[model samples]
Target: MSVPALNRAPDAVTTRVTAPGSRRRPDIEGLRAVAALLIAVYHIWFGTVSGGVDVFLLLTGFLITGSLVRAMERDGRVDLAAFWTKLVKRLFPAGAVVLGAVLLMAYAYFPRSQWTTVIDDVWAAALYYGNWHLALGSVDYMAENSAASPVQHFWSLAVQGQFYLLWPLLVCGAALLAVRLGRSARRGAAVAVGTVFAVSFGYSLWITATAPVWAYFDTGARLWELALGGLLALFVHRVDLPGWARTVAGWAGLAALVLCGLVIGDSLPYPGYASLWPTLAALLIILAGAGTAANGRLSANRLLGARPLTWLGGHAYTLFLWHWPVLVLHLELTGLERPTPGGGLLVLGVSFAAALATSWMVDGGVSRATRRLRTPAWSLAAGVLFVVPVLVAGSLWAQSIERDRQLRTELSSNPLAYPGAAVHLDQDLARNLPSLPVYPDTTTVARDTIDQTRACNALIDQTEVVTCEFGDPRSDYTIALVGSSHVRHWFQALETLADQHGWRLVTMTKNACQFSSGEQRYRGEVFTECAQWNDGVMAALDELEPDTVFTLASLTSVRSGPEEHVPEGFVERWRQLDARGIDVVAVRDTPRFSFRVPDCTDRNHRSECSEPASHSMAERAPYLELDDVPANTRFLDMTGYLCQDDVCHGVIGNQLVYYDTNHFSYSFSQSLAAVMEPYLLEAAGRAPEAELTLAEAALSPEEAAEAAREHDGSS
Candidate 1:
């Protein structure tokens, strides 16, 4: 939500601010205050949206339309340059200030892994494309559980700024066509805005239902809220309500805003049709009191015009800007997920004070100085005062991170320094025992994922069992790696063995999806997408019929605790493989630490980062106890290589072991190749040489048809 000052350029264009008079409405001022404060309160304590952003969008559309339409009507040509320069003056100064503050906070507290992202967001916010940046990150499955960005709240401001850049051109273009056809310019602009509302609203609805997380920050999905506000501005004067009716509508609209936040904040998709609740509520408040007095009896409009609210509304822009970062920073400083009531009040008080001081220094002092000249050039130049410094600082910070990465990459080249799991697996390879520096650089550890090993797993929403082939694709011996991300991480070892032994390797993995015959759940919801993907995997496996099918037979419940078991899904998948006469090499599940291993290792000694290895596995393999298990199924245990003395350490053989909480580091996974080679060879050697073409022929006619259908539908 931008400050109203950004919309309040000189009256040369906005003289027709309302139908009744050029003076601003006190009730609208109060409404702006309510919107800004509601966002702050909801963010601090409720951890849910308050739809205050939707209200702000409506206000901007109404105000911007009034300014532009009036300018075009008076001059016959819209001054796009002047409008842009004025916007720069009113918005950039405050935006730069906030971005600068965020950078300082990030440097002080955020981990080194987060610097690249923070810098990227600062650049995006500075350029007013923050919304797209956020939308893309939201859709990327690897970005899950990321720390909250302080500048994430700038997304709405970016959407508003983008609208400012495009809306005037649209209005001017439509007005010209209208004049050629002898229609009124205002009527033409209204038609154009209405079309935008309808088209954008439809897209919003479709996108919201299909990809709600991405939709929340997508500019296209949010454009309708602003367009709806523009429509209100174009014809607001045509409405004339009785005083008592106006009062009733005004009160109802305000209550509706409060209720909208309470009812649908967490459950429903936003800025689509669901957002009409708050957008229309704002429209009601505007329409009810448009160009009217608030002096009637039993007046909701009069209540809105209370002195304190109107005064606070004057500072709404800066208040909104300051509150979010302040809340996020306070939470970081306190190590609290959310602030207590006293802490919330403390955060609010500090944000209010900062807003006041910033307003005085920039809005009052620098603004008064800029107003003396009042030229477009001066406004732009003055607004750029803080922007240049932010860009320079961000550039320096990014370069420093890259420099540190280069240094680490060069130092990690020595095999003796980072032998990974080799020191334990191979006793002959001698080096300084436990005194070596950790490798893969824990500062940049999150990137040390299976993607670095294979770059081939599907995202969570993906249902296609896409295959990534490595090593000798023409080799007669084929090994199929299938399962969730846990198994995907083992590709570092599999790919190494494939290269050395001249065997073909194919990986079919989904991020959190296990190749299961039974029902699978992700985040406690029925994983229908994974179920669909599993069917595709079965079809593909039928066509490939590899000598040995390699997958996980055990599961580690990462969220609950460090505990391992052979799931029914694992047994079910192996059972189908058994029916096909394919050999199985099921590896025991890896230990998944409940805490961030890299984070712990970064700040503590190796001893402090160790977890009891007993927590990961039972005294005996759980799969061995199951009745009616596949006779051809074989088990592989590398627990001795990963754990020693009943302990699993964060850093193994001088290499960081895990990137996130559960997944293995690419380097550590590669280190297990030598130890795992013998077990894989034994399973593949005993398997019968069954041609895949014959396996396909063995499928029933109905099964073949279904497999063909699945292949056609896969991505």
Candidate 2:
């Protein structure tokens, strides 16, 4: 094998006599084939190749850097503009082709609603900000059942681009220092390479221990592989090896990489200590081809140096670009995972065909067409123009997805309606938490719960001050609504009745706040806010004993574990309220889902969203019971509003009862006025006391009509 004789070209190069000592290496191409195949297998079956992509990254850094270093040494100086020009020629055409194809697929197969998100992703990929955007989106690439994201493969490209930006200056600096320091040029280069390897390896080790994801994504932590190659390039000419040794090392290196997918598989943690195996394997192969394999017949035997593999190698960059987007879009459209065994094989076949064809058109056709233009600036501009729109479109699409999501949140303030609602909503009690989407903001404006305490002596014509005031004290009974967001939903119905009954409703509930006195983690901290607020409410109740205490107790026992029935330490808490001469009654919580059932919208799939039947509610009795409470505490189950016959449907009375997976809509609750009045009377011990019919207390035609009008206007 022989290297091409040193020569300079302003913009174009003519063929020169081959150097006597230089050679072309077949083992390097075989190694590349092995890396690509491993990455493909891992993305396909995953059980076969786990950390194989890191091997490819290491090889990319090594091979590309090795070529640049050799050119720089011969030229005696680095040409920044020329270097960048060559890179743009090498990378952009294939990337642009893949991006354009992805956009076309998005238009055909994706829902119109997803267009915004996909557009933003396109723009991000074009700008090389895809990895940062993914990080902010909290995307986990290693998850088992993720939706097919088009730019997930770009994280590796981002890492590579970071290296490309920094490596040339480092290499040129090392070359210049060698000339200036009066040291052997090769030795100076070795020192620079050694420094990079030592520092990068150390950083890699540190990040692997503390931040493996960052380590895997960052270029700095991965520079050691390229450094190892650069160092090898300078010193390999000095070593002498027997033919058997060369063959064994070369074959062994190739075999190690080929068998890597089978040995390591996809379950490995990735780019951590485990990556050293393949990186070292790639290193060995590159080193084996250093001295005797330039370009001669003996150096490049036909079997190892076949034109097919070489041509594939030539289109490797383009093939890599096309394969992932093809596989991703195929999966997105089919949702078949891969055509497993038969299906997977078919998908692989189609993917390979598309990749090769696109590679030929984009890499070969585009490169050849652009090569004769002669002007570096114009060629570079053409490449940038092709790549930029696709990238901008991807970025814009992602932003649009976010915007659509925001609009959804604004339309329905229900926590469950918005994907990231939990993080954005404020939970304070003074803010009209009774409204739909506005659950009880538990933290009172009067931060000290005791300061907000008051009595309802003005409206209630009763002996005991059972009601406690919190927000406004001007209304009739000064009724205090207590419990969690579940309790707050009832306030919409309660507020209507409260106004009619001349009772001022005071909300004292928080999201997930149980009546039972217990400590629980909320918003990443142990929250005693609910319990503390409850204590303050009870104290206020003692001070402002109104006509009666209207409290909504959540059905907490259903979600309890076998060993932990009700929340511990909270059972005695409610009893203390009862002992203080205040009535403590609980309304069971509505059912929550393990998955989102969006068809439960007000009118969509109404039949399927009907309340549960009588029989199904009875079957769920074990989960519905309030058996853990003291006898003095009364339990009111509102399950009837959400149940019909034997099954619980997602809606009631032409309204989306459960605004989210759980929690009733205000409109739905108003419709349940008839259902709730009887239960409220029974729980308040007034149904039998007054011997009144449930219909008398329920909402009549006039009230229902007015409420319906209000809902219509709001909607």
Whole-model lDDT, candidate 1? 0.76
CA deviation > 4 Å runs, candidate 2: 1-21, 47-49, 139-146, 184-186, 213-215, 238-240, 293-304, 392-715
- Best by TM-score, which number? 1
Residue-level lDDT for 515 in candidate 1: 65
Q: How many steric overlaps are in each model, in order?
A: 0, 71
Which stretches in model 1 have alpha-carbon errors above 4 Å? Answer: 1-5, 8-23, 295-298, 426-437, 448-455, 523-525, 559-564, 603-607, 610-621, 639-648, 686-715
For 30-63, candidate 2 gives per-residue lDDT tens digits of 4455566666666766534444465556555544
Sequence-dependent TM-score of model 2:
0.61
Please give the TM-score that candidate 1 achieves against the real structure: 0.88
Write candidate 1's Cα lDDT for 1-715 as tens digits.
Answer: 1112343321112312343235466777677788888899899889898988888888888878866676666676776767777788877887788889889988887655566778988999998899999987776565565668888888988899899888989988898889889997888999999999999999999998777788999888988888888888788867778877788788899999877778877877776678989898988888778754544656666676789987777677788888988998888678789999999999999999988887777778878877785667887888787788998999998898777867767866776666676554333332234355566765566654634633577777788878988889899999999988878888989999899889999989887787678888875678888999999999999999887788988876544454577878888888899899777889888876656676567546655776776666665668778886788788987766666555666776677887766677777888877667656766777323452232223333343334323432441
Candidate with best lDDT: 1
lDDT of each: 0.76, 0.52
Residue 262 in candidate 2 has what lDDT?
73
